[model samples]
Target: MTTLETPVPAGHRSLRQRAGNAGRRTTSDKVFNAVLTIAMVIAMVPLFVIIGYVTYRGIGVIGWDFFTLEEPPYRRAGGGYVAGFFGTLYIMGLAILMAVPLGIATAIYVVEYGQGKLAMAIRFFSDVMTGIPSIFVGLFVYGLMVSGWISVGFGTFVAAVAIAIIMLPIVTRSAEEMLKLVPDEWRNASYGLGAGKAQTILKTVLPAAAPGLITGSMLAIARGIGETAPLILTALGSVFIVTTLQGDPQAAVPLQIYNGARQPFEEGLNRAFGGALSLFVLVLIMVVAARIIGARANKRK
Candidate 1:
C-alpha cells in the first residue's frame, strides 16, 4: 500500500510567519484598555461619593461618647451607639462561632473527602446556599428559631444565626479554594514521611492554607456587619441600650440608620450619617486587619 503524503503550502507557512512576526498591541488593545479603565472608575465613583459624603456630614459627631451612648427619642439629647455597637459585637461573635466550624468542616469534606454522588450533592447544596438571600435566611430563622421553641419572635440571637447562615457559604467556598491551592507535592512529601491523610491535611495542608482561609473569614465577617435585611427581620429594632442578647431586642447600626434617616429631626439625620461613616470605618479596619494578619502568617512561614 502506498502512503499518501500531504505537502505544506507556502501560503500557510507565510501566514504563520506573519503571525509570529506581529509586533506590539495595536489600536484595538489601547481602545479596550481605555474602556476598561473608564468602566472601573465609573463602578467605583458611587462608593467613593457615599463614603465621602457620609464622612463630611458625620465626622464631627463621631467620638467615644457617640459609640457609648443610646439612641433616645430625643435625638441629640442622647449620645452614641453603645447598645448598637455592643449588639453588633455580640451578634458578630455568635455568627463567627456558628459559621467557622461548619464552614471549615464543609470545605474540608468538599476538598479532601468528596467523592461520587455525595460530593456532587454537597457541591450543589453549597452553591444553592451561597445564592440564598439574607432576608430568606432571616425568615427561616424566624420560623425555626423564633416561632418554634424560643418564641422570642425577633432578637439578637436569632439575628446572629441569620447572619451565620449568610456567612457560612462564603467562608466555606473561600476555604475550599484556599485548601485546593495547597500543593500536591507537599502532601506527597508529608505522606512520604509516614504521615496519614488526616495528619498531612491537619499539619501540612492547613497551615499552608491558613492565610487564605482567614482572609475569607474576614470577608464573611465584613459582609455580616453591614447586612441590614436579615437583622431587620430577625432582630427587629430597639432604641434602648441592650446589655444582654437573650432578654432585650437589639438594634444594629444599619437598623439605626434606616430608622433615623426617615425621621424629620435634624439630629436623627446627623446620627444616621455618623452611623454610616462609623460602619464604613469598621469594615475598613476589618479588611486592613485581615491583610495584616494574612501577611504576618505568610511571613511566619
Candidate 2:
C-alpha cells in the first residue's frame, strides 16, 4: 500500500479546468437571460402604450346612461351603448354554441382517429382557414345568406355564423395542440385496462385536455365578439338591439364603435372610445375567468 498507486487517466480534466468551464457556461446563461428579458420588454411596449391611451380617453366617458341607454345620435350626448352591448352578448353566445363543439370535435378527429389524406387535408385547411381575412368571411356570408343566394337578409344568426367561421379555426388549432399534449402513457394505460377507443378518448384524453380546450374556446369567443367586418356584412348594424335570432339588423359593440369613430361629432368620438373601453373590460373578464378555470382544472388533474 505504501508503494502502489494508480496512473492518472490521460484525458481526465482537472478540477480547475472543470470549474472554469462551468463558470463560462453560467456567464453565457446570464447573458442569454438578460437578452431575452430585454426582448420581452420591447415587445410589450406598444401594448402598454395602447392600453394607457385607451384607458385615459375612455375613463371619463363612463356613466350609468352610457352603459344602459341606447347610443345617441352623433351630435347628441345622453345615450349609452346598451343596444350594442346586448347584441354582442347575443351574437357571441350563438357563435360559441355553434363553433366550440364543432371545433373540439374536429380537434378530436385529427388527434385521435384521423388518418392519411383526410388528416392531412384537415390540417391544411384549418391553417388556411385561420389565414382567411375576416372581411372575406363576411363577404362570403353576405353573398350566401344576405344576397339573392339564400335571401336570409341581415340577421343576428347569420352574423353569428360569420363570427363562427372566424372562431372555428382558432378553437380547432388550439384544441388540437392541447389534446396532443396529453401523455401517451395515459392512453396506453387506459387501453391496458381494456378500455375501448371511444371510451378511452371520452373518459381519459378529453378530461386531461379540458382546461386548454376551455381556455381556447373563451379566447375564440373574445375574438368573435369584437369582429366588426363580419357583423357589418351579416348583422348590418341596428340603431336598437334586436333580441331575436331572426330580426331587423342587430347592433353590436364593434359596429357601434366603428360608427361612432367615423361620425363627425366630438360626442361620437368620445362614445367610440367608451365602447372600446367597455369591450376591453368585457374581454379582460372572460380571459381572467378562463385562466382561473384552467388553473383549477390543471390542479385537479
Candidate 3:
C-alpha cells in the first residue's frame, strides 16, 4: 500500500535550510580556526628555537663574575661585562629621559590640539622617521656631533642622542594611539567640571592613558637599547667602565656584543652570546616591570 505524504510548511522547510547553513558555517569556522592555530605555532617555532639556542650557548658563561668584573683582555679566559651592563642602563636612561618627554608632548599636540596642516606634517615625518635605518641615524649623528668639526665629539651623550632620535617616533606614534584610546566622555566630564583644555588633558586624559603610555615607552626603550650601529659611531666603545657622559667613550652591551662577535677567539664568541643573553634578560625585566606598573595604574583607575 502506497501512502500520500502531506506537504511540509514553507516555514519548516526554511527552518531546515537555515539549520543546514548554520552547521556548514560552524564547520568552516572550525577548519579556519585550526588552520590559523597551526600557522601561529609554526610562526612561534623560530622564536623558541633562537631563545633555546642562545640560552644553551650563553648560560654556561654567565655567573657572578660576568655581572661584576670588567671585560677581560683578549688573552684572558675569565672576565665579565660589568661595565657594559651598567653603561647600557646609563645610556638607555638618558635616552628615555630625552625621548619620552618630547614624544609625549608631540603626541599630546597631535591628539588633543592638532587639527591642521602642521599636525599632518608632524605625523607624516614621524612615520618616515620610524622607518629610517639605524645606520643612517648613526651616520647623521657621526657627522653632526662625532666629526669633531661640530665640536660635540663621540661619547655616551651623543650615543644617547642618536638612540633618543630613533626612539622619538616610536614613542610619539604609540603615545598618540594611547591618547586616542582615552574616552571622549572623560574629557567632557573634566570640562563640565570647569576644567580648561590643558587641565582636562593633564588631569583626566593623561591619567587615563598612563598605562598605555608606559607600555609604549617601554617598547621605544626596547628598540633603542639594542642599537649597536649608532653606538659604534657615537659612543665609540670603551674597554673599561666609563660612566661619565663627559666626552668619554662608553661601553654598552650591544657594543660589547658587536666587538666580541667580530673577534676570532672562542672567549670572545662566548662573551658575545653572554651579552645577548644579558640584553634579552634586561629587556624582559623592563617589560615585566612596565606590565606591573601598568596593571597597578589600571587598578587605581
Candidate 4:
C-alpha cells in the first residue's frame, strides 16, 4: 500500500464503519418497531372485526326489495331501510346547501382577508363547536325549531339544520387550513399581474385549492352522516317513507340503525346489521367518489 493508506488500528473500524454496521439494527429500534406494529394491529382489529361481522350478517338483507320498500314491523320476517335511505339523502343535501357557501366564505375571510382578533375569535369558536357533543346540537335545534322560528314539521329540514351546524365548523376549519397551505407565490403572481384581490381569490386562489376544499367538505358531510342523536331529536325517526322535506317525521340510517339494534326480534337485528353495513358502504362510496373527483380537479389545475 502507498504511504497515503493508513494502517488499521487493532480492534478499530476502518474509516467510519463496515457496511454491516451501517445496516445493523439496534435493540431499541427493534423493540420500538415491534411495539408500533402491535399497536397498529390492535387499533385495526376492531374495525376489521366489525366490518367482517356486519358483512357476514347483513348480506342476506341487501337486494332490490330491501332498497325499494319501507321497513316492515319488527315482528315481520323481513324488512327494509328504504325510508331511512331517502331521508338521509334529503338531510345531507339540505345540510350541504346550507353549509358550503357559509363555510367557504368563512374560510376565505379567515385565510386571505382577515387574520386579526376577529379571525382568532372565529377560529376559537369553530374549535369549540367541533368539540361540543352532538346531543347538545340536537337540543339546541329542537328548542329553536319548537320556538316557532322555522315553519317545518319534525323531519329532515330540522335535522338538516342540526347537521349543518355540525358540518359548518368542520368545513370552515378544514378549508381555512387548506387555503393557508396554498403557496403564497400564486397570490404574489396574481398581484404582480395587476389582478385585484377578488379576481385573485376567484380566479387563482380558489382554483388552486379546489381539490382540498372538495375533500374537506366531503369529510364534513361524512362526519354528519354517522350522528344519530341529532337525528333522533330533530327528525324523530318514522317507519314510513318521507318523500316531502317537511310535515312528517323522517327516518335516517343512523337513527334507523340505533333503533333497529335495540329491538328484541331477529328482524330488527337483521335490519340493524343491514343498516350499519349500508351506511358504511354509502359513506365509503362518497369518500371514494370525492377522492376521484378531487384527483381529477387537481389534475385539471
For residues 57-161, write the lDDT of model 1, one tens digit per residue: 888789888887787773564477777787788889999999988999899998989877887887787789989888898878887877776677677888989
User: Cα lDDT of all candidates, in order?
Assistant: 0.85, 0.90, 0.89, 0.88
- Candidate 2 positional error at 282, Å: 1.7
**For model 4, where is the 10-residue window of minimal lDDT?**
16-25
Which segments of model 3 are wrong by more than 4 Å? 1-20, 291-301
The residue ranges of model 1 lying beyond 4 angstroms of the native Cα positions read: 1-25, 291-301
Which digits, one per residue and each the tens of the lDDT, describe model 2 over residues 29-114?
Answer: 99999999999999999999988888887877888888889976789776888999899889888999999999999999999999
TM-score for each prediction?
0.87, 0.88, 0.89, 0.88
Instruction: Tell me which of candidates 2 and 4 scores higher on lDDT.
Output: 2
- Candidate 4: stretches off by over 4 Å: 1-25, 147-153, 289-301
lDDT of 4 by residue, 151-208 (tens): 4558778999999999999999989988997889999999999999999999998988
Ranking according to lDDT, highest score first: 2, 3, 4, 1
What range of 10 consecutive residues in model 2 has the weakest lDDT sum? 12-21
* Residue pairs in clash, model 4: none
